[model samples]
Target: MNEMINRRKLLQAGGALIVTFSLPMARAATPAAEKTLSPARVDGFLAVAHDGTVTVYSGKVDLGTGVRTALTQIVADELDVPMNQVTIIEGDTALTPDQGTTSGSFSIQNGGMQLRRAAATARRALLRRAAAQMDRDISTLLIRNGVVTAAGGEGLPIGSLVEPTALALDIEKDAPQKAPGDYTVVGKPVRRLDIPDKVDGRFTFMQDFTVPGMLHGRVVRPSGFGATLVSYDESSIADIPGIVKIVRISNFLGVLAKSEWSAIKAAEQLKVTWSSWSDLPDQSKIWEHVRNTPVVHDDVTSRLGSSRAVLGAAPRKLRSTYDFAIHTHGSIGPSCAVATFTDGKLTCWTASQATHDLRKQLAAMLALSDADVRCVYVEGAGCYGRNGHEDAAADAALLARAAGTPVRVQWMRADEHGWDPKGPPTLLDMRAGVDPQGNLAAWESELFVPDGSATFVPLTGAELAGLNSLGKLSPGGVLNDLSIPYDIPNVTTTAHRLQSTPLRPAWIRSPGRLQNTFANESFLDEIAASIGADPLDIRLQHLEDARGKELLERLAKLSKWRERREPDRNAEVVTGRGLAYVKYELVRTYVGAVADVEINRKTGALAVKRFYVAHDCGQIINPDGLRNQIEGCVVQTVSRILKEEVTFDRSMVTSLDWASYPILTFPEIPEIVIDLIDRPQEVPWGGGEPTCAVVPSAIAGAVFEATGVRLRSVPFTPRKVLAVLRAS
Candidate 1:
């Protein structure tokens, strides 16, 4: 591969074709080279090389979720090839087709499903060729592990069949696939191919990549989110070694140097003053501010019959309020990106989840056509939802444009938490009514939130461009519309997306569902307690779906529901068991969780000793990978509920480091037991985010059961726990 793309290669490839040489030799293809070898239609998202090697193109990038392994397994089985024969390519705009963002656990559900069908189609096309060559019927031939055999025992490898002739034919037609029971590779636990590279420090994360002659950049953030740059002294940093240039766009100031340490030193020395704004509301009164803020009511989000009349005429009624504050992504390593601009075109290597959309945004910012700008995906540190990755990419692009050289920009840890959009605060008031039969007759919910926590480009990209495009938010994250899988007579859920605060908000994992489920499930337990019925019996009695019931029942058995319910009553620590259930989207990924807790009365500390999670996300892809996703979700969500919160005053975010915003430590981590529901016949749902919503609810329920205290807020810190205990 030609690793360098200077003036010589720039002129050779011309400006019309995208020039990218980052991929290794096994996957590289120049514009001219691809034109000759490219097929009219993909053999279901796969290509065969002259060397008999196969490469799979996927639009989804792996964020340590193991999509590469699962997608490869699907394609390998359909193509009848061994794992070693398959090479997976992902998130390369110049190479792979667009599959939107790699979020909401849609990679496996949408991209994996599409590839599964594509591989099947490619196999049928190859079989058709074999039938013609052998002069035998296609049905009579057999293929296994990429080798086809005829009735007379004649055999041929599939690599020889994929030629220029096959390239001329479109092979995307629907083809027959093996039944679930006949699958040889799709359902098994396959080790992650990307892990060995990551384990040995060979993986090229976004922060690790270095383009030839690339400059290092470090951005200096302002006092707060809404502050504006007034004046800056450039010569103050002239004494720093290797001070290449100082790029400034309004409040977006950065220092570039030969090395990252030099850039950091220069950035620290350069003093930039910013204008302050009082548009920010009081952070202490955020709960009241959100509740009283002007909000547009959404009546059509979720509704059944007349809930008002049903609840008014019910035999019993209960209501409670739950609040979730804004939280930061708290990535261990801050986000980084590299960009270069030349010949009226720009290219960027980013860790953004939305590459295709990012390309459009960059094109719009630079006044170029979408085709002139290319955004290649590079894996980075943890990003639950719209972190500082995109903003860092924008920063690199601005610096590169000013310097006319490839510049790598990396945000300091403080800049990441201080400026990165946060997961918005949510306030929910849940009301429920029950009949004499102990079944829910009416359920009404009111959820109040800021302009939703979904992806807000203006929040990050527009801010980098000095444009405040914060009038309204996206529709993805304001999931105030909460419903239950259990049967109900009259149900109504209303979502109020209020005007946003000065702090811009974006998506983080499950978003409103986590807070909403905590409120809904806790309220359900309150109703059960009012009637003196076991929470399990109430849930089982109301559960109409057989799948939902099975999930809860299995979790109960795993947690030893009856034997350990009371926890011996006189243990060293207050012991209790509790359960929570939810179906993400009210239709996808049914989850039931049970938690066993031991609370220290004197210290007001809550320890979740063990957990049982029953998850049904349709068919299983990789059992180990699914377990990994669930385990991560459980741990991270517990951290959010117990120790994580983004605190800010009127001036700036005060909680800038790990000391101010501590997460659940290793000692706090509990033993997690997972039960995966594998139904290969059903289409697979998302595995990454659904299980997170119920974790908080289960833990809170157990805490309440242990001490007879109803805790509404999250991050059950000692202070908050003691306050509730004292009030009781």
Candidate 2:
């Protein structure tokens, strides 16, 4: 394995390639070789060897978050070295420490701090050693540009002292931590290190990974859920020239071929029959069953107030049922994995957010120790929590073990969309009780389809125990309002588990919060309209405390919510404004949106012209990245709200591709204005999921302002709008 490139060697007949090495000037008394060094090079006083090349490891990934640049700035600020000298390796299990996943928008909060502390510790050690050698106080020794110098003159570069010496220190438990005053770097935006490589097309993603003797693999999956591959007649593909071997496992059947194209071509030639349970149901029937289930995890799930009493005692109450159909992530790139098992060692290259979990799952499935399995992170095209790299990696490993060779399994875009674990269709029945004074008194909701509290994915004993003890199954955090951020006198929200197909329903951006907020916020807007109170004033009346107030204040200012007006433009076009609020964990984010829709009074074509969004996710890591995420969310939400839906004909999805299940294109994308407010960095909050929670509700509320009709169903397509208008 070459540590410089951070790639596993194929292990064939290849002569030794002359590797280049750069040695830094080492100071005396300090040993040259310290393998325990945690790539925590902040002051540039230390360097580690990776296949003879000096490299620096930063605990951040270029998950397109630009954390690599931010991390290098921290190193450059302390080390007094140029940015070019820093060669960063990211998210590699073999070369880098387990810095955890790059989701949750917490890379800088957690990973960035660890790297900074490590660097500070290393710098302190080097200066202390220099002071001991110079016979001066450790405080007098200042390090600048990879060298230690006395207060007056005469200095030595720390790199000059290179030997086998133990330089072990603990920076993990130091209290009080580093103050903001000591930070000369970290906060400043640094140039991204991955830009040049990406521009040059040299960055190696999972799609770019290729081995010298690797074979392409394709798995034959069951057509529907609970279906098993009864048998496969490979005799039909006997004439296919490049087809090499066929391996069948307990889960899936795989066919290996010489080329990726060839493997896919040969897979169609094989005859396969699948057998499913007799009582196979369709999407409509499945949703109907879900909407009528009883709440089981009430005590542990939702905690607002008693719904039965609130609904019965209220003088004025509004009750409506909202339905969200199943939708796939539809990531631009399909799921891919390449696994090689040779000489009792296993290495998997894939795009995964959960690397440690993937490694542990694969190791247990292969009956191998944790050390035998390694996962190499790759570039992800689009990961809205739908890249099931673990399944892909395990599938590849299973095929490789059967063939005794490395295999790369790649799913086609259609196959990925058809089999992708959807975000799970939800049925939300919400009831609100409002007093004559227009103040909210009671609120209640019944969440159908299991509340997404757990998943059925295969896991090891340790992983299962952790999930069980913590009670955090897949989308378990769906109870975003378990604490109830509003000041309603009495509130009750309970989750009911219903029997759906065995599809792994995980978090998709905001997940449960988005669905819940859309229902809650839109209904709140309706209640405000009914009471003749300003939407902004109504929200201000009950914003919990100070943090919620800050969000509402900033968002209202951005959208000018005080001067509200109903759409009275041309008869064919109308415009309106809407607001939504979301509080996930301890972070509070509010969004105010204004939308313009062009309606053809004759044709009934409703085209969204523009959407304005304002968000407050506290401290911003990269302002550009933050704004882009919010704008992207707006576009995706509009698309989903308008044309995205998985239509069902029988038991299978009919709208499987772009032709049927349409996404927003260039023409459909409206002008989006994103304003971010600086809440506070006292503790870094999340930006990724918070911004996503507002869009669906904003669009829904905006449409009501435009059409004077309530849309209770998702994917308010043009035809659906036409139907509503015609029925009126």
Candidate 3:
């Protein structure tokens, strides 16, 4: 896990850059092989018409993340064109390269970097042509405002120089990049391009999208996992106005209508009798369910020296268990997609994060080639991870392919909650021992979770429908962030994947890494308390990385270190501060957070008053974007810790509406402050998900500091807090 970036795919054509990697395997792979993998594609094309309007095409779409503006700024600055001249087209698979999904927070680091280098290469090609035409050396000329200049002798407009001939074809992997100080657009915070439309209500999300002759449709989902449709009476809805058709294959049932309300009303009246299944696990005993399952794979993720030997010689010891419950994405509205099947081709406009993957999966489902189907990304609800957006797309395609017409399918909110893939429940056991000096020891952790390969979270819609599935799983993240960064003598981390479970897990936000971080950081704080040491001080002592130390030290200052205090055993309302640190995937996105809380003694209610974070994600593409990502992480994580959980009965999911499943309210949000460390020389890293991994532990520490108690689980509700207090 070394620093991987600052990459350029070296080209013999004109020295254009692609992606830089620190992995030897990636480096050893040939250019053709790399293309076969996650190709660093420059799908963007610069078209300069006679009027000098520059249009750029990108494979990566903007998910309200302001990437359109950032990528536009990169191209404008690098190509020496006016910002106003650039228009970006994204997420149209037919016209763009396969840049893969916009997940993992790598859009800017991977997508924007390639676009920047591509524009730079285009500029170089323009200069080469200019140099040839003017009979002058390339270095002697300067470019400004999309025009090549030479000693005030001649000014050649880019529009005149482009096509009949294309400059991009001759451009390769290497090009002159602007130095940090010379950057005018890359580092600054520009206004987002998509915000104005959203504010004015002109923006159309998938829920509101309409096409000529498009029919509205709805699906009747199963009551529970393994449920089958026994019978359905379509004649019951025949009286409904504009009811076009009812399509059902196996358990999948859909109703299509000429009008939206007609479709919904008809579907509601179309009675579907579904057979139930009694095999689902009880929600109350999720931890037990996960632990009791047979192991599909059990292996130590990382080990250094023998932890058993070192801990056996220690003078003191402590052990703790942390459990995480199933949760949902909780989007503002139900998932929706629009699909058109015409002339043997299927086209879908969806909000899926992975369009290429969606296209491939849909093609496979329909028994068609990739060319016969296209998935175009459209703005939907802000999907944090694998939500039901893609599933809705599949529903639309399934119906549209059958109806042979344009169809828009939208799942009801209850249907969404009932079947959406959930974040897997986990039980983590941590054991460690402190030496005589209370400064050194051995550490070990065991993660009891769903089978690594069998339960590997699904990424596509086919997996959710149970018709098609991704066969294998990646080895990493089974116990990511479990490896201790502390300078310890012995440490061991093992992961046990459950052989089978009813739950279908998907990558929700940070996935298993966030759960693992919550456990490890909270347990570390517990260890500090047992050893009679301050949490911040203990971290500073063991963390040898300067970046980690810098984050902690900065957060400590921002949070006002002098104000934190020891836990008070007898206070009407307890108030205190606590700290936590994390590195995403163990080597990327270093983050530290300090949280302050006020806890009510009688009711055991907790309110986080403030949270401060220090982040080091290498280079700064957009300072405001980084701050927004950190702030979003803090708010969403606090919501997860305090109120959100997926609840289900033994045979069915009961948390089907907002009343059953809750999220953070506007009034409950706390003040979040962010500090960023920028190293422009290093490769830019992602700031999307990892910033959240530090939040739960920091909040837990703050609660413990306010009261003479410890929190091992999330959503430290009044009932749970009271139970812990009574037992203590």
Give the candidate number with the greatest lDDT.
1
Segments in model 2 whose C-alpha atoms lie over 4 Å from true places: 1-61, 71-83, 133-167, 173-185, 276-280, 293-296, 299-311, 451-456, 459-473, 499-502, 588-606, 648-651, 679-681
- Order of candidate numbers by TM-score, starting with the best: 1, 3, 2
- Report each candidate's C-alpha RMSD, comma-separated, in the order given: 3.7, 5.9, 8.1
Model 3 residue 508 lDDT score: 78
Q: For every model in order, what is the number of clashing pairs?
A: 4, 14, 11
Q: What would the per-residue lDDT of candidate 2 be over residues 1-728, giving only the tens digit for each residue?
A: 44323221431111011121221112111111322325433322224222212245433465555666666655554444455655565554544566656666566667766665666666666666777778889878766656678888878676653222313455633523334444444444444566788899977667676766679998776665446667888897888778889877654678899888879977777898887633444555756656555544543354556656866877899888887766777776777888877666677776776665576677767778777776766766667663455557777777777777779988776656666556777777788887766567887877775544543344312131122211123653555643346777777776666544324466666667777777777778777777777767787787776767776777667667666666763466566566676676545445555555555545656667777666665554456655656777777777777777765544344566788778888898888776667543454455556666667667767667766766667777777767776776
Q: Model 1, range 1-728, lDDT digits (tens) per residue?
A: 34444533432221212222223222211212342212235632567664446777677878778888999888888777888888876666656667778888889998887777767777787889888988889998877877888878888788777775563345454568767887788889988888898889888788787777789998887776677888899889888889898877766777889998999999888888878855667887888888788886554456788888989988888888988878888887798988888766787888888876677677766677776777777788777867878778878877888788889988887888787777877788888888777667888888887654433455354565565433236534557326666677788888777866546676778877788888888888888888887878888988888888998888888777766645543454798878999888777888889988888877788888888999999899899899989999998888998888888887778788889989888988889999899989998898899888998889888988898888788778888887888888
Q: After superposition, how far is residue 97 of candidate 3 from its true place, in Å?
A: 1.5
As for TM-score, the candidate ahead, 1 or 2, is 1
Q: What does the lDDT come to for candidate 2?
A: 0.62
Q: State the displacement of the C-alpha of residue 467, model 2, in Å, after optimal TM-score superposition.
A: 20
Worst 10 residues of 3 by lDDT: 6-15
